[model samples]
Target: MFQLGKTIVSEDILEKEFVCNLSACKGACCVDGDAGAPLTKEETKILEQIFPKVKPFLRPEGIAAIEAQGTWRVGTDQDLETPLIDEKDCAYVIFDGSTALCGIEQAYNQGVLDWKKPVSCHLYPIRVKDFTEFAAVNYDRWDICDDACSLGKELQVPVYQFVKEALIRRFGEDWFSELETVAAQYQKSPRRR
Candidate 1:
């Protein structure tokens, strides 16, 4: 791992590749996970504020789940997370045919809401663990994302490059710039495999 600002980033982000192939996986990440999407304290408030606007875009079951459980819940680990539907799919999930998608994002895409889904959803395949002094940024490998990994390898897109916008959103532009510089130097070094 290498330090960038307050984040300690894993080299796997630069070494591995990933690009979501929604068609292949059918958005399994949203539906198959045991827990709901992670949410920040601010995000829980945003969900509560935007629920009225985002409601129409969601599935009835999702709406029911959210209504029953609230927009977000505290997990056993005490971390904030979106509510789940029947302990399966996320409460904000909507279906585009058989494929699951984020209703919050759809609302934002349609201009019904300003916030585009939770940052955790936007930063898939890169989980951030925040501590008092810094955050650990690492690549998240899942069987559901195998197709994405293959597609990313085929497209020659590194994990860091693929999640550039999310990384910039999580960190700042300057932090991302420094990461790019580090990536450049790492690429030239024999340490790269």
Candidate 2:
């Protein structure tokens, strides 16, 4: 088992996993207006610079929801207090009574994006968090199981590398050093029940 400030977690809990399909999910994580997933100040700056370019693609309610929530940090519950957009599903999701389309992804592919948004936006269903110990959020619990939604199935990308880069970008080298210590411990002894 892996320990995070006295909290022991089981690594095998999510050893093998997949991505989530928005088509099947209500997109609660994105549209529920949760506040805990707040972006850092640097992220906010990047978003402000890039959001304007993709404004048209974003659903008006989605934009408003983000603004209402204000800024938040990773691994905290601060952002959960924000009000949900439709209460029925994610505001940015467009359902034609069948498959759901992500407006943000469409806009990005159309070359309308300004800045590199957080991986969270593009890497839905696979949430990587830097808590006392690193862990992936289980999207299945939310009933978001679809072949298209499985992140592991589509790309064999290295999650640790992505997280390291993201942390370096947000908190710089020093923060990464601290993270490495925790990561090393996790590698030595993965969490168990």
Candidate 3:
């Protein structure tokens, strides 16, 4: 791990490759997880505010879950997260044919809402753990995303490059710029493969 500003970033994000192959996975990351998408406290408020606009984009079961459980819930770990539908799928998840998708993001795409989905959702494969002084940023490897890894390998897209916008969103432009510098230097090392 290397320190960048207030974050301790794992080298795996630079070394490992991943690009979502939605056709292969059919958006399993949104539906197959035991828990709902992780959210910040502020995102919970945004969901509450935008529910009226986002509601129309969601599936019936998702609407029902959100109505019954609220837009967000405290997880077993006490972290804020989106609500779940029947403890199986995220309450904000909608389906296009067989593929699951985020209703919140759908709403964004439709220009119905200004906010995109939660930053955590936007930054998949990179989980951030916030501490008092800094955040720990690390690549999250999941068996379900095997196809994505394969695609990334084929495309030569590193995790950091693939999630460029998200990392910039989570951190700042300057931070990401510094990260790029580190990446360039790291790439020059004979140790890199």
Query: What ranking emerges by TM-score with the best candidate at the front?
Result: 3, 1, 2
Given candidate 1, what's the lDDT at residue 136? 96
| Cand. 1 TM to true fold | 0.98
Residues 146-174, candidate 3: write the lDDT tens digits: 99999999999999999999989889899
Q: After superposition, how far is residue 108 of candidate 2 from its true place, in Å?
A: 1.2
C-alpha TM-scores of all predictions = 0.98, 0.49, 0.98
Candidate 3 accuracy as lDDT: 0.93
For candidate 2, lDDT tens digit of each residue in 1-193?
4443423433432343444445555454554443323344465555556655655775677667556643222334543222235443344444345555555455767878644445555444334454554543322233444443356446632233334454355446874565457655555663522
Position 123, candidate 2: lDDT: 40
Clashing pairs in 3: none
lDDT of each: 0.92, 0.46, 0.93
Q: Give residue 61's error in model 1 in angstroms.
A: 0.8
Q: Can you write out model 1's per-residue Cα lDDT over 1-193, one digit (the tens) per residue?
A: 9999889999999899999999999999999977988988899999999999999998899999999999999977889999999999999988999998889999889988878888888888999999999999999999999999999999999999998998888898999999999999999988675
Best-to-worst ranking by lDDT: 3, 1, 2
